[model samples]
Target: MTDWTPDIVAARFAEAAETARRLPPAKVQGYFNVWPTLLRMAPEQKPNDDERHFPPTPAAVERMLEAMRWMQMLDVDSRHIVWMRADHFEWSQIAKRAGSTVRTVQRRRNMALSQLTENLNEMRVVAASCK
Candidate 1:
């Protein structure tokens, strides 16, 4: 079986965060512009200094979905801790939100990653046996 490491799981979480950022913004349904095209103001152009964002590929989106599914295995607190880290939040920030110390937050994040790694490794072995 392909061994799944905590580092690999953490990397997957980071990739999932990047994929989520690249997704298009969600809009409310049935919202239509009532203004006439002729009277509409020109759209503002972004400054050239801003980086252009491209949508994630289908494969990346699939991987993101899988990562999200894996999060279901974690408890709410662990999921929040892990996601915060994946989103690149500092340990101090996560600790503040969690009302805990930075070291505690770091420990929780590491535990969450290890849990995910173990579960994924088991899943890989099971899938291989099924074949």
Candidate 2:
């Protein structure tokens, strides 16, 4: 097998933001046919972030969203590393963005690319099978 590079899988491995969908709020049902009239009015104040303002999110939906968030983070890390390497930018510049020492940034960049290597291989296999 040949060595896979970040440039090759950057596009395929990364999920497009446009394709992502926000899960709908859970439906709330009335407890009984005769409910109090005083409770019908919607609150005018903005919802507090601390409370669960929206209906309870489903477990599967929440898990999927969390997984997507993780994938997005990895995608950003992978692409940024690819861009930095491909552009041939100075270590100091990369370090500034990472907020780390040059050596640390170099190490992180290498790890990110290495992790993404598996994704590239999987994509290649899928592509070949489709042909």
Candidate 3:
């Protein structure tokens, strides 16, 4: 894949923001509800340092927003991802909540995670070019 310029990354962020803005509130909330544990894994912001180089540009900010959107997409899809994990013992419970069968949930969740990972890799390609 070709590296994305900062402008291209911003454009992608705008596109994703538009898509996310179009989602219904309930659907967005449902997505949030589906991945509560993932929420707790969010990294805290590091302390700012005066000596640090590469102060953030608008392009970098846009890239960060794009990364956020990708993460949100992953969060939305991670319900099935969790269910599919071999260590996930609450699969039956999750399936019941989702009104799906355990086996179906497992399959679907694996598929969702695979798709998310692929998308994340694409996003990373865009980010790497910014530097």
Best by TM-score: 1
- Clashing pairs in model 1, backbone N/Cα/C closer than 3 A: none
- Residue lDDT tens for model 3, 12-102: 5444444444343454443454433222222553454322343245665575465465546655545433423423347777788668788
Better of 1 and 2 by lDDT: 1
List, residue by residue over 20-100, the lDDT tens digit for candidate 2: 223333456764435432322345533543332332346545544443443554656555654564455687888887678
Better of 1 and 2 by TM-score: 1
RMSD of candidate 1 to true structure, Å: 5.3
Against the correct fold, how does model 2 do in TM-score?
Answer: 0.40
Q: What are the clash counts of all predictions, listed in order? A: 0, 0, 1
Q: Give the candidates in order of TM-score, highest first.
A: 1, 2, 3
Candidate 1 structure, TM-score to reference: 0.82
Per-model lDDT: 0.87, 0.53, 0.52
**Which sections of candidate 1 miss by over 4 Å?**
29-52
Clashing pairs in 2: none
Superposed by TM-score, candidate 3 places the C-alpha of residue 16 at a distance from the truth, in angstroms, of 24
Whole-model lDDT for model 3 versus the true structure? 0.52
Weakest lDDT window of 10 consecutive positions for candidate 3: 33-42
lDDT of 1 by residue, 48-113 (tens): 423446669999999999999999999999999999899999889999988899999999989989
* Candidate 3 deviation (Cα RMSD): 15.0
